[model samples]
Target: MTRMPFKKLALSTAAAGMIFGAALPASAAGYTDVPKESSHHDNIVRANELGIMTGYGDGTFKPNGQLSRGNVVKALGKYVVKHSGLTPEEYVKTYGTASVPNFSDVPNSWADQELVMYSKIVKDMGIFKGSNNRLMAGNLITRDQMAEVLARTFAFRDLPGAPEISDIGGSAYAKSIEILFENGISVANPYHPRATTSRAQLATFLVRSYDKVSKEESVMPASFYSELRKGKVSDAIVQIGSTLTELKKKAGDPEAEYDFEGGIRHVYGKYEYGVPHPVLEEGDPVTTVTYYFDEEPSLEEVMRHMGPVEQTEEEEDPMEYDYLWYHKGDFEVFFEYEWGGDTIDNVTVKSNR
Candidate 1:
């Protein structure tokens, strides 16, 4: 049987507009300790409103308190998850299972499960890193590490006109810190590269980042599922029932060919350009068109365009790879996540006939 392929979804930043919305309303939610007079009070309430950070059970958010690595991960991870274009519940089901519990210092016991998940979430998403192969959950996050986190989170680096900070000299964060300065997260004189970060500082950074991270230019990759249902992919104009002649007319001569199912599989390039064989003859209707991405697309970027994923009752997916497949009258759309759920490996569209 021909292998059934599936892919994970990805992010479209506009979906998180609320995260980057206008100034906090006068009636917006606030913490006990977050007075309007506080320097970071607006950002603190905004962060809390977005669920990126929260207050203590006593209703006080100690903004000036030092943030630990675990707390940092939790804050960044929550922001990523919320903006991933998936609802909190859907995000958990779609991405929560991919977090590998591998932090040496983070035990798999019930007590540390949340920490383990957030630690793995930020690590796998390339939002944060650990030291000496340890998560260092209890250690205070420094200015440099926080810079790296925000840089990775918003995909910011190499701001051409960004100002230089003399104090970050020779530090790894020298470049990434430019994002903070470029985006005006902080314009502190003599930026402290090694200083421990406070919750207030992190909240300020997250709030200030809204403009850059939630840019209107951010959108979903082309909808493979939608195109599949329409019987054609964007790059290749021919539809599923399209003849090899039509494909050749549109996509040019094949670069390679091999046995596919019972028919000949045509390959145009190294990527999954187009494959239209599930039969025994040279002349047959195109069976499938596969689009390959050089870079792995995130589930958030893909799903927003591909539409809702099919539901399964299973609490924890037992499959080795994350699979999301869809079926219409005569078409099948699939995206398989080989490495993990956040990054989609490939998307394949096939004629059900």
Candidate 2:
């Protein structure tokens, strides 16, 4: 496994779209504290509307309040249920009530049944590990601890290696922290791990993680295009020869842009955003659409969605671009140079005829 290179891409500037469509109108479930101008207003509102989070009895969502470990766990429980295609009663029934108490602080009482159940689920999934049989449910969680919990909840442990973080190298949460960096959830700042995270910060993290998970799960398999392709590198939206303007209109704005020799390359993946058009040079359209990965995906993962490769070749040199090419009839996928060079960097679609 090679260490994946990090590329800085622009963030998407498009209007925040609904996660799974608005469960309820924001106006219908208004929170007094979260103003329309707040940075996390949309995320907090969406999470609340989806039943992942809730406001106080006074109809106030303390956007700047510190979230405790117990509260975080409860929120995650609701999140999983909403996205798991399972009803609340169904999940509780399937996982069963917590017969045995795992944490010293949270007892298996009728009043705490819901919390205990959620705690047990997270514990069984290895997302929340208590210390000395004590989860310190009421204790405020640090940023690093939050990273570990979120990473486990999303099952992001198999991420490709990331740059060394001096402070996190020896910690038990090192891998989880790395996954956070790899998935664009957090940055590698020295003091951030130990810092306390606010409700606003957690809201952003949840929304971003939700989008990432959704995108990965929603990717169309190559076989899906069997009838759509028509033996050409084209989808219902755009074809090989389609102009850059047409592509933008169909796919909305690209997340990132890269400058190439004759034209510009646009990326439509988890991270980055841009609206530049590709330069139209003579021979080919010169425009290339590349797909970036939040976590470096293996060749098998790519092939799973792209079908079998038609050809494979290596490009090794300093003068010329170094990359590995996997031809798939109508398009060629490129894996850029790294230590092992097995992770895909981008894909180029063109007319094979």
Candidate 3:
């Protein structure tokens, strides 16, 4: 599994599009306090609704506070359920500083469950560190530090073809930074993509990234769900047709047709790709595109292939292009292309998640 840099891309800079067409409104949904216009408003709301995050004591989620290691754990505890991997108590016993009793600073009360849970996630994630053997959970997390932690949490470490680096400066956490950008997890960079990140920004970023990771996998949104639920009979029919057309080619069955369920079409075909196409007895209901690797590519190959390219201002700039390299794998893909007459520079990749 390669972990590519996922957030270092250029901003597409399209005008504000409509809100997420399928999700409920933020204020009405009891998910977050930020306004919809804020880049992370929906993410905060969604994380709250899913029981993955909460606002600060002031009834606000300070979107710009510097994050602390303890705070990071507190936020992550919202989702670290007990499982075969490890239990919360076990994590605390294993990772808690020996000098501090398990309940020290954490009252041995039911309200302290969050602290305990956070301790476990931090431990399991290998992010708990302290000064002189004391787990300094209270330390403020720096920008690059947060990046390294995020990359590890998402299993972006040891990507199949990660680049060799002497150091990412003090910013070892640069790997996970992309998760923040691709999902619109944070907007610390309102006008620029590579701007420095703050702690409060990191908090919101974690909340949103965790929320998205918990959702269904590898399924693009199908417009048919909303159309069918709204009783737009004509629209539903059209979508169904379009979906069928899209899947027929992928599934490689000329005779394939589909039935709809659970907001997705259940299409059966002899194969999923590399098949013959047939004219639909009905009109073309769905159109689909398939992404084929031009070759049996590896991270090393991608890096080698792209190493000599330069950024073209006439084309997408470096920041906007960063995410493309990281989206495919854990290798934290970087672009060393020349930009604006500079001979060399690097950027992370961003994903739309």
Candidate 4:
């Protein structure tokens, strides 16, 4: 847990892809201490604009100042509200009125009320923890601790393919740190997870985390669909949203066909090098792409590529799950997950017609 020297880190690929609309605009003279040439200037400005972090009344942002745990919780509470779509009033109503204390150190005093509430909320969500009934609110938070907070806040564990961190494999925050790296939030090679984070560093991390979540909730751009409509199909399209007509055009003809109730089922091998290999037997090691013109593609496929459904209907039947819907730009996609099965039986994507 030795601290590594701070160096200029590059903006992550995910951070670069973020729509500026997701973050507030930066002011030219946001903070006196943060020079325009500072590595963390953009993030600090963005955080200030978003009201996630701020400076002193004298217009100086102590960029290199150590961030306290209480302050971190306060900032993260605002972020959680934004990321989870909770109104500020709703958040206050939910956590503000609770009289029960989760930590012995967090007294019922008015001075500590806000921090205590936020601490309880984050703790309930498994983001923050206390040892020996004390939250250590005054202590400066470490980089690894920050990782755990972000990871739990955004539920980053569900994201696929977490990368390995050479130095922090054995730490308690290892998995969370890996998620941070995998999502392009932390680009530091020797991540220095145990080092105390500065206000500037924390601001950068929070803004990047927000960007990552925004990207996850986003769908493929309209330009992508325009390419798909023109029969320009690629591996990227398969991983996201695409029409059966487009998939057929990309994969060519199907090897086998079967009659279903409403439409014909066309089955194609997972094509590689312009060749479609056949499935010899049940459970064979082969790539299968099934397209039912009357029905949509698999639910798993849609969710896998398009992220989670934004809305879902409540189920009337106790045994059944609700139908899910996603609206991405001009596209509307629907999915129905079958009972006792991972595959989504029905999917339909419609454009503004």
Candidate 5:
């Protein structure tokens, strides 16, 4: 349990959740040095233990790989099943057929079941459309596309109260963005709507949602739960009040794109937990020497093993994962980890997606 040379600050700040990639356990940072024979040898091993995501082919978890739209969709689907549990049939019945157009890329036989399932959800939510009414299943998905899909899937219909002057404008996604804002689903840049999203950002958003939807007894920290049981309103509020406040501010924006009749809808997704490291900035010591541990450490006692911590600068410009550490300059480091047969690693360099 090595402590950093820097001051030991209690992680009680309102923005701590944002820094940690949405309440991720400290073990997600993985040790800077790993043993070759360790059971959790690859990156994302800790994330896998937390049941957030999985890895890919070749027995390696490409944690730092760029997250594609398909990957994002699949991950979202996994979360839905874990948290919301919408069966394929149920998903299709609720939001598919009508919204998804027939496409040559996605034939009835190819990914037929998955296509129907996702299309129904996207369609019913009115967040996604086929490229020319065709589901481009084979194409790599982008960050912007996922943002819209996530916004719609979350059921953010309109901004809260009256739309501010700035909130009222933007492309078709403006309204949806507003709704996302109001619901704490996203906090968009005041200046742009087409800004890119990052894997870390997505992770944080999903984690928050997990907290919102999970049973209070399930996700709430035991200490906090004890307080709540004793009706310690102040203590319980302290644990989550700031997060709730941030979400409240986000609600200011309205969902202008599609106006669903009944508020926002809740979709299923998994909660990925891991410590996020910032990408280094230009002129910073190239050998500052941080570690990315890829092992399944005991979450209860892992924070002590992070070694003497030396926090870096706040990202000048927010990327998708700005809430975590920002990738400075162009070069980024993505420590790979394998989890659930998928890769989940934080990128420290330029945007991977």
Candidate 6:
């Protein structure tokens, strides 16, 4: 049968949960090139785990490599398939073997016919408006184009106080970049709107977008399974006293990490784990566990979960926020309230000794 010509390519963030929800057996960053110091370390590693972004056969993740239209569609397709609540077997049965719409440039002999099929879904979704029967799959995607794609995918809402980025003056995608800025997503330091987006930047964009996208999807998309991705003290992967080694072994590489106080701090979305001072190099017995929420939990809710507050202390930066402390045997838990607020925005577990 003769295949019909296709029109476009694009994907939705709603499909990311399925891609990253499964259990990972080992470290997310097995790449030889990206170290903890690399700016792209966190995002690249996390993206790797999600299968939304990946490296070549070589043991290197070309963080600085430029992305092509073909690769972008493929990655987005993986995200959607994972989050669509269907297993690989189901996807293969439904999409892989099903009628795949063909792009003019993406030939029948393409190495991965699966990717060709994914582009079909993306085009069907209207992200890829392949002009003149051509889906320049080998062409690069500019930073501006990426912004437009993400804005449409995540349905970025207009927020106040958006930053003005450079190089998009009269560009058609200026509005898209504005939406990203308003939504608190930065593209790159230079904001090179016309430049091709790098692998590192793309990974960072996807990882950073998880929260924003989840919040926008009111029905509560199954981005990850509750059993697979744990949070909160009751279901947290790591505890107040967990060793750094244990944290890494269980949680994989953090999306962001840094040296804080004496030990190290790792950031996984809104969750932060820290181990400070003495035995810092050995990386054991975590010193703190902190989690932030988009909305502050009420005092009553805090008490309901953690019992009565034992003490309250005004922050040294008194205008910044206040802390409500509750003792848990040798451990201490604190509810942090932003100044002039009625509820708590963050909760932390730490050593009382």
Candidate number of the best lDDT:
6
Tens-place lDDT digits, model 2, residues 1-353: 23222211111212122222113333445778888898788878866654445556666767788878887877765554444344657656644434435787887763666678777765644457789888888889988898877765664324655656668765666766777777776654663677777877787777666566545432333333322222333233454555556666667866667765444556555422222344543233423433344456544334333322334544455444345444444644454434345455544443443
Give the per-residue lDDT digits (tens) of candidate 3, residues 1-353.
Answer: 33342211010112111111112333324434565687666656654444344454445655565556666656444233221123546535543422233434443453656665566444433444434434456676565556555544443223333333333433435444443444444344322223444533553555555544434231211221112112222111132224454544444444433332212223332111111135334333332211222222232223221221222222366443232232222122233333322122322221111
Model 1 regions lying over 4 Å from their true place: 1-32, 49-51, 57-59, 85-101, 221-272, 275-353
TM-score of 2: 0.50
> Model 5, 43-77: lDDT tens per residue?
23433344554333334443334554545555554
How many residue-pair clashes does candidate 3 contain? Answer: 47
Local accuracy of candidate 6 as per-residue lDDT tens digits, 247-289: 8888788898787667677887778888775544546777788
lDDT value, residue 65 of candidate 6: 83
Worst 10 residues of 6 by lDDT: 1-10
- Taking all chains together, each candidate's TM-score versus the true structure is 0.58, 0.50, 0.38, 0.53, 0.38, 0.51
Which ranges in model 2 have alpha carbons more than 4 Å from their true place?
1-42, 45-59, 157-171, 188-191, 218-353
lDDT of 2 at 60: 74
> Tens-digit lDDT track for model 1 on 188-233?
7588889999878877887677644444232334444344545566
Stretches of model 6 off by over 4 angstroms after superposition:
1-30, 49-51, 56-58, 87-101, 107-111, 160-162, 187-190, 215-217, 220-353
Clashes of 4: 0
Greater-lDDT candidate between 1 and 4: 1
The lDDT per prediction is 0.61, 0.55, 0.37, 0.55, 0.35, 0.62
Question: In candidate 5, what residue range of length 10 has the lowest lDDT sum?
Answer: 265-274
